[model samples]
Target: MRLIKLDATASTNTFLKELAKSGYLDDFTVVWAKNQTRGRGQMDGNWCTEPGKNLTFSVLKKMEGFQLNKHFELNMAVSLAVFRTLDLLKIPRITVKWPNDIMSGSHKICGILIENSIVGISLKSVIIGIGLNVNQSYFPGNPKASSLYNKTGILYDLEELLHSLMQNLEITLSMLQSGQEKVIHREYHSILFRKGVASTFKSGDGSTFNGIILGVGNEGKLRIRLEDDSLAEYDIKEITLLY
Candidate 1:
């Protein structure tokens, strides 16, 4: 549980990955940045957060018995950690927007990006980056982005929030080692945003359609029941849920 606090960094995920490559980092080593110059979300999306107003950090998890194909389980575990931590904070309407984004009602409050190091079909290690909105009252361009402060009208201590997140993350990540992947699957899907509800989606080909989010597939793909009543699976890049 080595923790490094940085005043500013390009990306904690990048920093931790480099440290891990040096072969000196222990499992659960964390790098936290006060100001992330180039923080990234899933699919290289820019995560814009005011300096010192949010939680931005990455964790290094050394894998022991995990395979390469079980990556989505990591997503589930991490998402549930943030989701449950927010729950402990009494944030209302907590739900995980698939692949891995934490949502409070209709607004996104957190984003997770996971990078894995693989060697011959085995996961050597995993780098998890998390950006959580804490005390930011406003978002300049992202209308659907909100923070714990905005949602609760109360300012929170960033260190306390980070502590809670780390504790929950440690417990959830252990589920992977304990063979509780099925428990993660069941709980993750239960509160999934828009599960079983008719929703609009845009395909990669620029076609708009309607569908219902059935659940997530074994490989972490979104399972949707299309308008034709056909069940289709899609990874993050192939589809976008239009609310």
Candidate 2:
């Protein structure tokens, strides 16, 4: 395990990807930036964070037994890891949105973006980018954003929180490496946000409709039961859950 702390950077994920390309990455290596200038979100969306007020980091995990087909299992494991860390902190109403967004009630406190390095039928490595709002109180235009201090009314030590998250991640990853696929699947859907509840979603063609989230597929696509009682599968870019 190696940790690199940066005062500022364009994006931690980008930084770590460069390291992997240089063949200098170690398993469980982490790159964290205090001020991420151009942080990323799902689908090329820009992640906006107040400098020095949040946790923006990327973890490089060498996938020893990771299969290309069971990619969503990795997502389920990582999402559960973050959920466990937040739940351990006594953060109320922790729920994982489909894929890997961690929500506190209705507001989002954390986001994860995974970049994988694939070689043939196996995944060589995976870069998990995490953006967690910690102490910042204001998100100028984003009303669905909140922080630990914003919700808990107490300031938190960023280093302490990051350490806790890493510990939880290790435990969850161990479960994954041990082939506990069923367990991970069950646990991930247990706290999934809006699961089994009717919700609005927007399609890639700019059409909106109501559907019930029916958990995720093995390949990470969101499965939804529409009004007609038919099942539909959508990849990350194909649909957006309208909160």
Candidate 3:
């Protein structure tokens, strides 16, 4: 595992993408930044953070012979790893929003973004980027964001937290490589947000419906039971949480 720390950068994910494209040797190569000038988020949103008060890092690994369709399980593995790391830190009020957001009491604590490359019939590599709010005293402008410090009332050493997160992530990836998809599936569902609760979801075409989350399907799609007793599957981009 090689840890590369940056005093300041545009974004750890961007840095890792460049390294991966350049064919960097990947076992456990991590790119981290204490401050990101242009941090990114899913759907072009900004990942706001206080410099030196959060954890922004990316993990790159070469995948061999893994099926491309199983990518969502990989996401679940990473998500559960983060959840476990926070749990070990004695933070018990965390849950994973389907597909990838870590939340505590309706406030988001972490966000994950994964990018992959495929070459012919083989999987080249995957870059898993994580942004975790660790010790920020206050979020700039959002009632929906919260940090570990705000929730726990204790500041955490960024390095120590990163180390623990990487360790857990490595373990989770190993489990996936060993064909333990059920393990990841079960654990993720156990900590899923709003399970069994009726909530509204917006489809890609902007259609909305109320349904109960029944857990995720084996293929990593969200399974929802609609009012008509019909089952619907939605990918991350195809659905938005109305709550």
Candidate 4:
């Protein structure tokens, strides 16, 4: 549970990865920054953050004996942790967009990126990076982004929010270690976007469809029921969120 705070950095994830490679990062070590100059997101998109007004951090853990195919469960656990943290702050209208985006009424509040290394059938270590909009009042050009301050009209202390986030993260990781996939799975489903509602999805092969999101499968794939009542499974890249 060691928390290292940085005044300013390029990216917390990259910093932690370098530390992990140099054997400086240990299990439960958390690295955070008040501002990120070169923040990144899924698909190489830029993660926007207001200096000293957002949550940007990385958690490093050494996991062993975990199935590689179950990595999506880790995503679920982390998303649930973020959701629960915001919930505790009494932030209403927050929901988890499938895979790992935290949204509040169609505006994104947080994003997660997970990277891992494996050594001969055992997970060496995992770096879970999170970028959350905390006290920022507005985004420059991203209309789909929102912050806790914008929603609640009250600013949050960065350190206090980080403490709450780490506590939830520890609990979620413990549940994963204890084979409690059902706990995160249920929570994730409960907050899933477009649940039981018709939505448009674009697949990797350039095909689009109108389908309903039933729930994620045990293997962590998106389970969609098409208009014809046919069930289909999609990996992260296989489908794009259209809402």
Best by lDDT: 2
TM-score of candidate 2 versus the correct structure, residues matched by position: 0.96
**Which ten-residue region of model 3 has the weakest summed lDDT?**
18-27
Between candidates 2 and 3, the one scoring higher on TM-score is 2
Cα lDDT of model 1 by residue, 1-243, tens digit: 778999999999999988887867788898999999998877777877999888899999988658878988999999999998999889999999887889999999999999988888888888999999999997988999999998899899888888889999999988878999999999999979989999999899999999999999999899999899999999988999887
Q: Give residue 154's error in model 3 in angstroms.
A: 0.5
- Candidate 3 matches the true fold with a TM-score of 0.95
lDDT of 3 at 241: 86
Kindly list the per-residue Cα lDDT of model 2 for residues 1-243, writing each as its tens digit. Answer: 689999999999999999889866678999999999899898889998999989999999989557888888888899999999999889999999887889999999999999999898899889999999999999999999999898899899999999989998888988999878889999998999999999999998999999999998888899999999999999977888996
The per-prediction tally of clashing pairs is 0, 0, 0, 0
Model 1 C-alpha lDDT versus the unseen true structure: 0.90
lDDT by candidate, in order shown: 0.90, 0.91, 0.89, 0.89
Worst 10 residues of 2 by lDDT: 64-73
In terms of TM-score, which candidate is strongest? 1
1-243 per-residue lDDT for model 3 (tens digits): 899989999989899888777865658899999999999898878786889999999989778787888888988999999999998888758999988899987899999988887876657788888999999877767878898998989999999999999999999999999989888888999999999999999988988889999999877789999999999998777899878
Pairs of residues clashing in candidate 3:
none
Colliding residue pairs in candidate 1: none
Better of 1 and 3 by lDDT: 1
